[model samples]
Target: MAYKMPTQKYSGKILEVTVGSDLKLGGESVLPFYGFDGNIGNKPAIGMEIWDIFPESWPAAVLDVFKDAADDPLKWAAYCVEKYKPDFICIKFEGASPDGLNRSVEECAEIAKKLADNLTVPLVIAGCQDNDKNAKLFTKIAEALTNKNYAFLSAIEANYKEVAAAVGLAYGNIVVAESSVDLNLAKQLNILITQLGVKPDKMLMNPGCAAVGYGFEYVITTLDRIKLAALEQNDETLQMPIISPVSFEAWKVKESVVTQEDIPEWGPQEERGVAMEISSAVGVLAAGANAVILRHPRSVEVIRNFITEMTE
Candidate 1:
């Protein structure tokens, strides 16, 4: 069978960032660089999320996956690493922030240290939603893990440059800069982080994620524009890699969490959750995301396999 393929051409190369001392988050050129005729130097890495506190509000399907280790962050992280074999672990300091559980900074650092020592793969430590609280949390962890060189700091937002600067000073390899859906805002935050002496290769930008049927189009457009600009050698903005919290979007969707009783004929909740993760991931890859923070070991396995097939 003969078919016509689009002969589109792209410019510039995807930037690569090595996470741990031995791990390489390699550069990839071409959207969803897994397909034939594209260039993908590194396999897209998977990161599983571990929270300090068990999320009681999570849907049954998700809660079941973490049932045994929900209350224990270290155990959960180890379990995910052992089971899913993820490339890294993203330890979410959900309740340890001032606006949340308000745990002491020392305690947060201790938890991060535990994960760092227990897991061999790279680590990502994220603070609670509050900017002030996260800044304080990341600062402490950044200092504690300075010598480790395997941990990536959660974020440095427009309002949190002080914390980001502290992290950069401590030699953290990666820091996430988040902005609303605005591309300019995303670029501006990246610039702010770089101004703090952090190199372009060490920064990751997340424009925030929206669930399917809930502003997903806007998220896609934002990511597409950002990638397009980067391909054109928009040096200031295209120099860093892009990350997306794909699981966050899927877990929050009603179809992913609601029971059949709440919405009959929705099929199995677990299957729906997996589907949501896959759809969001595929879309984000098309938009030029280099990495993703995901949950559910099953979904990670599926997505990794899919990426492998595409790259082959």
Candidate 2:
């Protein structure tokens, strides 16, 4: 007699989204659901991070790559496109923050336009850490790039509901929600956004990722719970596509920055940085991540290959 395997039936619903002119999310069942058992519908997309101003405080390893284009957002974006062939460009308007250089909204908009013109892929515009400032800046960029379809405008938090509402009304691609590490809070934020008229299909969740040896386990656990809830069809908030900020986690860890002399046993800083990124991204993929923002081109390639294998 031959042994037979039982087929697993996934209860969760997958959201389908067409970004810009070419990108599409194919609908399928299963968590972290690539196109394996069933049709995943969309291939995971990668976004290279580009800051509005020169990152003088960045780790030496990161600084070394962007040394030439750090001061110019357009040139930097073009470099990422030419070198990495990223699926999308994620531009962070750090210069517009109050604590930072405080570049004006108009200036930020100008930078966004230049990048949009230079790149053929879709764009995701993120404001600085300040909610109020980000709201104003994000709105300006959304309006400026209206000609480009499928641009993801973010970070609609609890304090910036009004701005989020405006972006929703504009019908531009938008990312709304929070990183509470709590399932209820995540759902509540999504509910709030929907109440304001934002469609569920257009929203993306960022539960946030902590570095390895940090609170990574907790982050993974939270994401796992969210994914389980979504798969069980018990929570609609967790159903939307998820975006993991992998680069942010990689850059913040001391292991990724400290020199060999400072942390001799930790090994090379460059290797550490890459390891941090790959580990963080792989962990999130297990939990449930449809998109990821990364800094290094090598990590992106490794992750892409890993995802391809999983789906195969």
lDDT digits (tens) for residues 1-312 of candidate 1: 899776445676667877767666647665656355467667777788778888776777788887788889888988888878888888888777565678887898888888887788888777777777777877888877884554454564645476667676565646778788888888888777777787777767788787677788999999888877776664556556777888877887888888877777898888888888888887876677777778877878878887787677
lDDT of 1: 0.75
TM-score of each: 0.90, 0.92
Each candidate's lDDT (Cα)?
0.75, 0.75
lDDT of 2 by residue, 15-72 (tens): 7655667765525566665344455657677888888988777777777877798788
Q: List clash counts for every candidate, in order.
A: 0, 2
Instruction: Using TM-score, give the best candidate's number.
Output: 2
